[model samples]
Target: MSRIVLITGGQRSGKSEQAEALALSLSAHPVYMATAHVWDDEFRKRVEKHQQRRGAQWTNIEEERWLSRHDMTGRVVLVDCITLWLTNFLTDGQTTEQILQDAKDEFDRLTAQDATFIFVTNEIGSGGVSENALQRRFTDLQGWMNQYVASRADEVILMVSGIAVKIK
Candidate 1:
């Protein structure tokens, strides 16, 4: 059976780092599925910093959209995030239902594969209420997505301050 892990936390809460560490521990040649899009200089710098942290051991796959059909083979796959990927889908006119469906489908597909899968997501709903409709919608959708993924994961971890706490 394949191992599926879901890791979530606040921004800069070490979720991504923990996810990477978990993936690395599983397999030597892990595939890093980076969902962030470098839309500006700041985002690019952030991506670069993450890359530097991962070093040359990770095989990076820069996927900005359409994550449902990616092939994860041979190596353990680490999805750096699901929220940003969902946000990109929504901003490109995809509905919430569509986003959820795609995410679920991808999760199922990855779990069926031969390698381990580690998913990283933000704990968006823990923060205070958003002041705008879009923000609220995104938070709600992300929270639901996190729950859905966690339900299927063999292990669920909540990270804070670079420390990992297993929730499931």
Candidate 2:
């Protein structure tokens, strides 16, 4: 059986740090599966900073989408975000419903493997409604995806100002 853990919070709330720690506690050489797409130089620098933090003990996999393609069997895989992963799908110009369904199916397939998964995600809908149409759409998509993942997670942690609050 696979163990699924979800760590979610607002921006800069330390969700990734907590997820990495949990992954390290579970396995010495946990896989750091980053879903970010480096759209510019600044973002590339941010990705590099993350790589530097993990040290040489971690195995990093950069997969923007199609997460199930990678065989993560018998390994602890920490996906450092769902937001960016979903954004990749969004940019493909798929309908909202289609994207959501695809994400859910991909998640189901990935979780079918016998591995421990620590997912890091942002709780972007926790604030006031966004005025931008695109932002609002993304927020809705994010919330639905978060709910789906949380429902299947064995444990859920919400990071607030560097504090981990168990919400499973």
Q: What are the lDDT figures for the candidates, one per model?
A: 0.83, 0.95
* Top candidate when judged by TM-score against the true structure: 2
Candidate 1 lDDT over 93-143, as tens digits, reads: 777788778777866776777667898999989979989988898888898
Tens-digit per-residue lDDT, 6-49, candidate 2: 99999999999999999999999999999999999999998988
Residue 67, candidate 1: alpha-carbon lDDT: 57
Rate residue 41 of model 2 by lDDT.
96
TM-score of each: 0.92, 0.98
Model 2, runs deviating above 4 Å: none
Candidate 1: clashing pairs of residues: none
Cα TM-score of candidate 1: 0.92
